[model samples]
Target chain A: MAWFGRHGDGAEHRPRGRGREPQRVERVGLDDLTPDPIAVLGQAAYLQLGHFEALSRAASTAPTLEAKGSLSAAAGKVLAKHSAIIAELDSRGADSSAAMSVHTAAIDRYFEMVQGADWYEDLASIYFTSGLLDDFFGRITGNLDGGAKISASISSDAGSEDIVQLLADGMSKDPRLASRLAVWGRRLVGDTLLMARSALPHPVNPPAGEARIEPVLTELMADHTRRMDRLGLTA
Target chain B: MAWFGRHGDGAEHRPRGRGREPQRVERVGLDDLTPDPIAVLGQAAYLQLGHFEALSRAASTAPTLEAKGSLSAAAGKVLAKHSAIIAELDSRGADSSAAMSVHTAAIDRYFEMVQGADWYEDLASIYFTSGLLDDFFGRITGNLDGGAKISASISSDAGSEDIVQLLADGMSKDPRLASRLAVWGRRLVGDTLLMARSALPHPVNPPAGEARIEPVLTELMADHTRRMDRLGLTA
Candidate 1:
């Protein structure tokens, strides 16, 4: 009753973040050998849940009331998005929890490994990972039937808007923070990419799936680079 | 811009919890010599922020993803309400952070002392304190102009509906849980009352403030009783 229900056919998808204009949606020329719809929804929704969770933790430990206030709102927005994904699953007649529980272990593991040593690193972790994942999902969701509208409906800024501001503020205050966060920001991408790769179906014939995902991954990285550039950090 | 900017003149307020019709708002007619408007808003808003933080922690540690999903949504709602309060402060031309930061240490201290030993206890902690404080704030908010509209504007649940349901479900599954949580619920009230009392202004003649607050506290307790009754627990 709790975990086995698959209400939706699992094709649901949506984008998140500071609500940046999605990069060229039609330019990626990958084939339509898609993964299981439930896999996509479950993995995707759980990742959003993961971000919401991570952000919630960051908000709790945030040093300033202002940071707590803004970060909490951003975290709220992310969780609301996660709930919307679960609700979509429910509408499909899937047990929402069941749809997402499958990915709980992997998502939890990612959060555990990526927990930052301080607020700046934590914010950087949130910025880089959410930046990459949201862009990747924005593309995937864009391809889904109603995803474009859903993507458009969310706040124009990705949830990372505050992160970018806070990091910039911090880096400006202490030059060391900039260099250290740049390193941290770069370190985040490797795990983030691995997690993104996990969201896709495991390739039965490695090259076939690899060939399809390679271009998409490149776009995601490029998007990540752009976000880092906004903070004046190297990707 | 971030702190010390008072936007609203300190009259904004709202209620939260399971969408129960506010308990006898007309009947709890204690005198209107309330605490400073800014003080009330900051303390109330920061208290909600603290719950959001505490619940965020709970969701992170929740053993099951189902709990995480519901807790996270409830947390988001709380944070949104907190943000709305801040927005009201912003509208009044107040620095939301400066307004809230004054009570941050006090609110933070309460949260630190009241944290539960486990998820069940945590849920109960959320249930009891939010039940009590929301009722108190609801009373205060109801008395202010435009407050009822904003209170009503929020989701019918006090953001604790999920918490109530989850706790009820958990206790039924484990008799020991219900008993332990009942005890935990009682222990929570002492600290919660002290915190609530601290929210009001100090009087030159202490009995005057205490006199008005006594009846109000009584009503808050009755409301807590009603909420606890729902859980088949003693207040």
Candidate 2:
């Protein structure tokens, strides 16, 4: 079983961004290590943007008007969340474009690696993968240098109910979707968790940093399971 | 010169939709013929939806944050217009999805044929193609069976000011962009005008029908030139 962060992609060693990098380490809660604020904003902003791009494309191929409508609306919400984070970066007087772009290459690489084979798997990927990434964000929202305010703004953007309903509707029509999507959901976790891992403080000391990331990965998987269960998929 | 409508792909012979074919020459004005109301809503709705799809994808590859924002906002507007048309279809008690899906294959084929070679060309494609279409609809707005209200709705959706500004910004940055985009703009007209052609009646009688389409295509060409001029591109 491949563990959370490393999938033999050597992603841990990859430079997330040029010049602006994740913090070495920041102490927040007793055992909770908050990542660099810039890193958080960059990844959060670009991740939602990535999902917006994916969902919008998915809408074009969506077989039914109902599915198309659901996908478009969901794409809008994710885009709104992305804009909120960019707004946060702007408020801090940062070069919002630079901040967001720094993470673009990394995020793009992640999406390229995880494209779904079919429409159902695509939705499942966004559902489970975004669920884990959002859950991970919520975990690290500790005093992010007023970046927590953006997190608060983002909290209201929670729960892609439209997506969940669409998926559940799919299951009701075709019973076999359950097992097939369950497998797809499991396959998504490793890459998603790696994305979450990259958003954290750069592991200056790999062994210790890898150890510190354990609890966060476990919670992300747990949240991922709950999200899958809601869709009647066995996570 | 391959005149408007016949690039010889046998498109005039294509069955646009299975059951809801365009009305066979509805005599509206003295010289003008309005297509089927179902056909109008189908093509109009799907065309905007297609723009939203292209712009949304284009935004991902946009090189700058400003360009991304512009593309995304343009996408949102095009999406709004598409939804408004669907709402109009519903108000008439027509099956909106079926109406839209009818034109999906033809419209998809058009986009596939006219894809831009670069970013500027892509924006130009959306700008010039959508301009000519909206202008063509405006020309035929003579008592379109309550469809004119949607036309009025779409009229306000006119003039992608942001896209014009984006292309204009590009020209100011690079002196050579004007001519390069102009060449791309010319390449697009043949296919776009053909798409405009496909939206009309199936041309039961070709010679007379082609003769009837002349003045309208002339006006469409004039409007296409004006749209090209807006981007500083020669038609």
Candidate 3:
């Protein structure tokens, strides 16, 4: 609850920026951003690499062949995307190695915390955890000047339709999976938020007078809820 | 031993075909081949899929980041190559699923016998097992009419330079690794031949009058020895 408590004051001022007309606000390019966007994006890439590693582990241990193949294919795409992001960061002269090292422990701990007990749990974890991270990155990239390509690449590289179908088929085979995954989904959101609090910098944790963090968190939660609903799970 | 025993009579007649002209082969097209080249290719694809699965498991359990990344990348390429082979097999109306099942137990047992003790062992196993298979496939494809593309793909996809560098780097860091990997490499060739004898048809276990099996095995052993020499290991 540190995340919620930290943003309590900012939550009250969320409506202040909404009333301003879009044209009245100054456009902020990548250089004008308060915190370095490249660093943030680089960290995101590194975290994704960790997710790829975890997904690889899950895919290998998956009980069913269908799940195994689907997960493996997904891991390949994630690795490709991670490689692209690292290359792009290198081109921009960003210290991607530093970025990767800084967030490695936090993201790794997040994986340790949510490691699944069985195939169903593993599938649900991969689906929800990756889906939420993609949503978060998608939202953050929308506010940046030079991050559109990276954002699009990450979005495109997210799990394929085959993965979605695999999960659906799994649930259909065992109706009880619906309820189990519903609970698993909630746990995924909680752990994801905790990971964000630890792994990410501001605007995840804003300065005293800044209120941007609350709305971002709100939007992310809203998107997560919708995703859970689509999966026939309660958020 | 079973493999050697099966070809004992053939071993005695190995010198019979050495003086034949290179142009005497009569250049048979894909359609003229006995036992259906597509069936052979399909079975190879199925076996490669099994290797991909084993590589994934090894990667997940590997002890070092370098080993894990190298193995995972190799697994990805293997999976992609397997997919391409499956697609081609489908186009040729070959039953890839049946081909896959035919040699499943043999290939699976081979994997079971050589599963690694740690990251170093896994890397050596992957490097040597895959290297031998690629060599074997390359030789077999040379005799086939339409196997060039598949052969090239498998060879190109075998192991990247990154893997070789990874092994070399590991050995440089710990000089004793050369001796350990040398022993591991010999085990790999032995286990690979055992699997081949159990799974492959024909020349590997030729009839009494056909002595071609010895020369082929001899050539394979020579190639493997040269590879070991290249790696600074004894044959």
Candidate number of the best TM-score: 1
Docking class of 1: medium
Q: Top DockQ: which candidate number?
A: 1
Q: Which ranges of candidate 1 are over 4 A from the true structure?
A: A1-32, A153-156, A203-205, B1-32, B151-156
Cα deviation of A204, candidate 2, in Å: 11
Give the Cα error of residue B163 in candidate 2, in Å. 3.7
Across B108-211, the per-residue lDDT of candidate 3 in tens digits comes to: 67777777776677767776777767666655654556666776777665554666677788799999999988888888888776554433445323453234
Docking quality of model 2: it rates as acceptable
Which portions of model 3 show Cα errors greater than 4 Å?
A: A1-35, A62-66, A197-200, A203-210, B1-35, B50-71, B95-98, B142-145, B157-159, B203-205, B208-210
- The global Cα lDDT (0 to 1) of model 1 is 0.69
RMSD (CA, angstroms), candidate 3: 5.9
A21, model 1: CA deviation in Å?
31
In candidate 3, what are the lDDT values of residues A1-235, reduced to their tens digit? 1222232334345346566433222221112223456766666776676667677776656655555556767887877777667766787787766656666667778887777777667767777777777666654554456767777776664564665677678899999888888888887888887665443454422452234344556666887888777777777
Provide i-RMS per model in Å.
Answer: 1.1, 1.7, 3.2
Colliding pairs, model 3? none
Deviation of model 2 at B120, angstroms? 3.8
* Reproduced native contacts, each prediction: 0.96, 0.52, 0.20
Relative to the true structure, how large is the alpha-carbon lDDT of every model?
0.69, 0.71, 0.63
- True-vs-predicted CA distance for residue B196, candidate 1, Å: 1.8
